[model samples]
Target chain A: MTQPTLGVWDVAAVSALLLINGALSVWLSLGIARQLLVAALRMVAQLAAVGALLTVLFGAASPIWTLAMASAMVLFAGYEVTARQTRRLAGGWGPGLGTATMALAAATVTLVALVGPLRPDPWHEARVAIPLFGMILGNAMTGVGLGLDTLTTAVVRDRAALDARIALGAPRFEALRPVIREAMRRGLIPVINAMAACGVVFLPGMMTGQILAGAPPGDAVLYQVLIMILIAGATGLGLLGAIVGGAWRLTDHRHRLRLDRLAPARPAS
Target chain B: MTNAEILTLRGLTSTALKDCNLTVAPGEIVVVQGPSGSGKSLLLRAIADLDPHQGAAWLGPLDRARMSGPAWRRMVRYVAAEPAWWADRVGDHMRHPKRAAELAVSLGLAADCLDWPVTRLSTGEKQRLGLARALEDHPPVLLLDEPTAALDDAATRAVEALLKRRRDDGVAMVLVTHSDAQAARLANRRLMIRDGCLRDAVS
Candidate 1:
């Protein structure tokens, strides 16, 4: 059975609940009334636009259309990754490295899931492939972004120690081992926490959405488990690629710490 | 052109230093004296291959460019003016704790100083330990920047004596110092740097 559809009035009724936030801002003199209004409006408009695009994409149901949308999402995620950094790599490497790693990891996992387990009639079915790709890409992007930021920041912070180690005859990778481990830990912690807390602490958004869409709870639970595993795999791969690639970029063949390759850190805002 | 030189720099140029040439025979110390920000540290860093430079440095016949950075650095160790210690405990930074403890005692550090947390170190104590860490390996060449800048008269003498012993063991050195008296006591040849240019200091 299909889930009940949401009408304009039903959406408006929920939207009106935001008035409580606006009223709270006004009463508390929080000075966030305008910001709250603008943010809510932006969310509504953006989601509405995405919904319209998805309707057309579902109607087309072509692999090319699905892949095109996925590419667009990955590109946007790449920008987000770089934008989130405090000290980005100099040159276009910040965006280039993030986009390349995220795309490689997320796409690989998504393709494997589509072909192996889901086995949709058309393996690249827009509905199944796009959402799966999107979910994996979102998590992978966050992991890669955090990993890269940590790598660059740590390299700068530990410049003297790294140089000392290098001077003491340690190989570049050996000298960077501590920083790389820290970056990997930072990137993977969120996914690990989410996995641990999924059923007991909170139902994941994907499973909640699936249950609301009238799917069997068992099926939805299985989907959530599969998706979570895929996300973890993608995030781990992405973080490894990004951090390793970053390490390579930050040092030269001479094994000197190439701080010049990093943009000077912006003063803390 | 003789093979007697353990370390040789031919036209080394860094961003802060102009083209420079020098050589140090085994058991010799070449003291570099300069005002602050006059590229003394940069000169040593370039020789150690820590900074990018435009010149050739040879450890005997082995050209620096031909060697891996770590291998080159291992052979030609550069101990910074304010050395960095990575680990929490003092002994963790040393490759050989037994030998380092011996060296530390010679440098006027307590016998148990190696077991002390790094946070407990005074600047003078850290300086001595940093020297001990570098000397533990007995590299062929030492590029030392102000090795005793933080030490008092007695501690400075202790460090100088240790450096003299290293030299007597055939380790060549390039030492940066601000004190003329220290240079006179340690240097086989003294050079002064100003505005990135190196010139022999009059005796």
Candidate 2:
């Protein structure tokens, strides 16, 4: 086996891909160059680390460790995504820390077993199952994080009018109806816009990767569509969690927005 | 609530307050006098429990600290010289009307001022709208901070006339004005804030 072709894995190739992504980073997220760089670095490290672990386990021909690693991947991705979104509303880190991990694990298991006909034994086919879950959950993490950020900022800015609604005999959640609607509007609009621009602007990463692996274009597109649907569903659920749960931070038990917490700005003198 | 919608402050010390004791009985007009930056407005806010101070302040039966922030403001109407403008329309005032059409009519404003956008309103119109908003609330304690500062002759006369009517109806008011003519025409209790202290007006 002629080293499986040096073209398949090369440092220069990877570096070139990173450089291109860095150059395009400005287009992806403006005014946040450092954040994009850090994200790219994280992506490289996380994928490479996982790739190495899987190779070692599979190379040793052990199925059990491979299955455990895949499970761990799903759990970790989900937990991190959920934690980032809900930490602010939970008021402290500990309450919503691992909830996302659980959500992701359940979604992954449900997708593999019930949603799709892909019934390969996870223990035997650890590579496919683990990486698939990683991509699925990773997309969800992004959507959820963005959704929560939008929701929090909107709530903070429009807090006065929002609280005014509450005082006018609107229920706490009812009072936040306008804000909640605006948050969801902002959260969903970006993803929908990107999806519209897909294919024409740039081949999605999943479809492109599939085509590079010599898969048929049509088949790759089909797979990408399925994955996209799953991601949207996951995103919707995650945003719902953020909107409903975050309502508590805006108001107390009596349906009054915490005004003492939002004291009017005082003069510096 | 209680008759004492405003918190009673005795010797309240803060950057916004001097050593002062203030009691605003229900249905009484108490106008505060001072030149610029003497903390007259701050004293009103302090009585409203909107200021941070060391002195004890009681609102009705509850301590100022204990009652919720929204509840406290609901009982006290504070019309700063420049009220916050969230929209461009005068009509949106009906969105949360504390009073009815009587005051709007009393101020010689057409009912359409209710529908008029804030952008279309003159400075005098906004001040009138602010006063109308305060009156709509019908709070037992009316805190006026330079209510006429932004007005021309006509708007000031209109506001003065409406305030007189409200006073006749026995709505308690705390008017903060630098104009002696304005105070002499409107105040039942005349107090001056000077160098962070409150005392009866010398005149």
Candidate 3:
């Protein structure tokens, strides 16, 4: 029964699919190509480095090092979101959104660790928990950036109403509640749609890969479903948390919105 | 003695308000007038501490730089020449619906305007909103920079009347305007700001 229906070459086939999709993305969007190329090259270098290290580390390294690496990944993800957005604005808003990234990654890791089957050694299973947590944070980071950009644009676009609020009796965040809510919804739509389309439009990469590696198809599908739910949950946390967490910065101590703090549009990139 | 001079600017220099020294007395309506770029509005901004100035500013007898930012701002409210906006609907700013209605009616604006988005409101209506904000907050002194420069005659009158009423209520007002008629309408004292200095009108 172990008649090797597919050789190691099958892994090559999967990687080829990743490249085709990446090339198609480049052809359709040059800007996306810039991001995708950086992401792809970085991913390969990191995964190869990790693979090389694992043979020795798993055999002898401390579990503490593995856990430390996970924490660092989450922190860096948060910082990445903050610096990327903050550099564009005048003040602390970028770091403020970084708080969203931290919350997102934490919630994902927490949910997986608490609800899923306990690994024989979670800290040691750097292979499983770290990758999964990272993927969730990465996706949620995209959603957050979209949501934050929308919120910033909406605030500026609606500046008159905002100024009037300070003129009136409304508090800063109180005045911006509606726009923030809308931006959160906008940022979340793509991720939610993906969740809904799962198993219908295409089998997700996690499930397909697991099945190819000799896991029962049903088992892989079950885990895939769980992961999808986790992703959606983490993204929701990121979108909602970011919208609320950052309201304080936008408003003055007297509860008035600070219009000058908004990031202006850059020369058309 | 002058209720501790709600706003005092010394050695104030700015593109908005050039080298100047002035005191805004408690409960007095003071209008600043000059041609554009003469720093009439800059005087108000310098007092409010919203713009950088070369000298010292005092709010209610406290050095502005010495006081905590929040404390200084609480004592002084700065209304820009172009009103700043951050909301979509006008009514949304009125956290209290009843006050919104009262303010809209008093400002010669329809109560339905509360429901209207800020985008739909004319420049004049928006200015009224800016003024309404300054008034609603009940700040001791109002630093207005050409608050009526962008308004129509009717809107202008409505705002002027409100300022007149506020002045009668003993609220100190710093009104920056090029229109002498506007200065005469509400200001008990019209100080001329020219060449980075404040002077009593020769007349």
Give candidate 3's error at residue A212 in angstroms.
Answer: 3.6
> What TM-score results for chain B in every one of the models?
0.96, 0.86, 0.86
Cα deviation at B171, candidate 1, in Å, is 0.4
TM of each candidate vs. truth? 0.96, 0.64, 0.72
Interface Cα RMSD in Å, per prediction = 0.9, 5.8, 5.3
lDDT of 3 by residue, B79-110 (tens): 77677655577765554566657776888888
Candidate 1, which segments miss by more than 4 Å at Cα? Answer: A1-4, A267-269, B1-5
lDDT tens readout by residue for model 2, B67-156: 655565666656767664544566564444425455666666676677776777777766777677666756666788899988887768
Which regions in candidate 3 have their CA more than 4 angstroms from the true location?
A1-61, A64-104, A107-117, A151-164, A167-172, A175-183, A200-202, A232-269, B1-22, B35-81, B84-89, B95-112, B115-117, B129-140, B192-203
**lDDT score for residue A224 of model 3:** 85
RMSD of 1: 2.2
Best by DockQ: 1
Models ranked on DockQ = 1, 3, 2
DockQ of 3: 0.20
Better of 2 and 3 by DockQ: 3
What's the TM-score of chain A alone for every prediction? Answer: 0.95, 0.71, 0.76
